[model samples]
Target: MVEPVADQVLRAIDQVRERYYRLIVIVGPAGSGKTSALQAVSALTSAPMINVNLELSRRLLNLTERQRAIHLPRILGDIVQETAAELVLLDNIELLFDVHLHVDPLRLLQRLARNRTVVATWNGTVGPNGLTYAVPGHPEYRRYPTGDLVIVEAKP
Candidate 1:
């Protein structure tokens, strides 16, 4: 039997405890149950789940494009800090990939994980090139080397 995504993420959390950046990214396509797995992990571990797009959008609503780009990292850090949880689950991170944001999505997550464990749902795939979001030639396309990040695949 295939191991459940939540279980895989839970195991990853434990495994990254001593790492500099305690981040576990759950990668899958749309409708792949990444959110459900994150919910399960949240319920099981009592960690707070954050909707990144909603929260970040709300916080950046009144900011100018330049302001948003300038303050994005600090805003994100504040959001994570507000959770006050050792482990934070983030979903709907598509906003972070917006070209206007002028920020590296994976690096933002890594920065957040420096202070606490972060398990985030990534609507993407892990390939030989590394973790990818969207596709080449797409406005939001992004790819990053796996580096020290732990990854959990959520298949439907």
Candidate 2:
């Protein structure tokens, strides 16, 4: 069965479709239904959604941490080709930020968002622009940035 998309996530997807390279961040306290909301959106849009768990795949890979950044796009590319989900979702983005990296995960996300739409679930905000990043250390993350990322948390 398809999940119900929250009003905010629905609105975010609508906004992203209107604007290219849109980066939107979804932030909330733990167990606050962040992942649920993302799932709902994915179902609502019928876009293949991938919940990229930060703790599991990004860190456990056997390759060097630096290579993760370089490798991530390839992995994502495979997934995109396999699934062909127009909208991509990255869940639990905290691990990507906290881990020591050879490549910037933010760049990868930005690069992916360049053409297709990406809805990422982050722990907090990222930089001031472009990347749809979570606020650093805010523990409330949801971003869709198109060169200038300005997040306004909605009441879900």
Candidate 3:
């Protein structure tokens, strides 16, 4: 149900990149072209890229509650400045976890959403209220549209 990446999407992309829209949530599944779309956008624009592979030791994507507190933010900020990137792109955001046992991407999301453009990749489905789900029973995300998060759905 993800709306095609037509002129509207392209325009949205331009609006965020050109005019500096704080948060650009690219909520989509593994192969939803979230990364690719961001890449293409970055390539075409002056945005820098910051791809943090959360596959290090933990399997979460939440920025808070992680024992590696101090350095991560510094590193993320550095990455942002390093690329002089106006747009920040995140991949495999499903790993963003929190102590609440629910995926807590708020801190990180809020941080980036504050002044930069962000597009994240996740694994889940589109829920009723334009939310993204890691699994059907898990928590839902209202940051982006469901279709935008899910690329395809295989019927059971």
Cα lDDT tens digits for candidate 3, 28-143: 45665666666666666646555555442232244554444434544554555565555566655543442233334645654765566665544544446564554445444334
Where model 2 places Cα greater than 4 Å from the true spot, the runs are 1-5, 54-60, 125-147, 150-156
Ranking by TM-score: 1, 2, 3
Candidate 3: lDDT of 48? Answer: 54
* Model 1 Cα lDDT, one tens digit per residue, 1-114: 999999999999999999999999999999999999999999999999999999999999999999999999999899999989999999999999999989999989999999
Q: After superposition, how far is residue 19 of candidate 3 from its true place, in Å?
A: 9.6
The prediction achieving the highest lDDT against the true structure is: 1
For all predicted structures, in order, the TM-scores are: 0.97, 0.66, 0.59
lDDT of each: 0.93, 0.58, 0.49
- Highest TM-score among the candidates is held by which one? 1
The alpha-carbon lDDT assigned to residue 22 of candidate 2 equals 56
Worst 10 residues of 2 by lDDT: 146-155
**Span of ten consecutive residues with least summed lDDT in model 3:** 147-156
lDDT of 3 at 113: 52
RMSD of each predicted structure? 0.8, 5.8, 6.1
lDDT of 1 at 84: 94
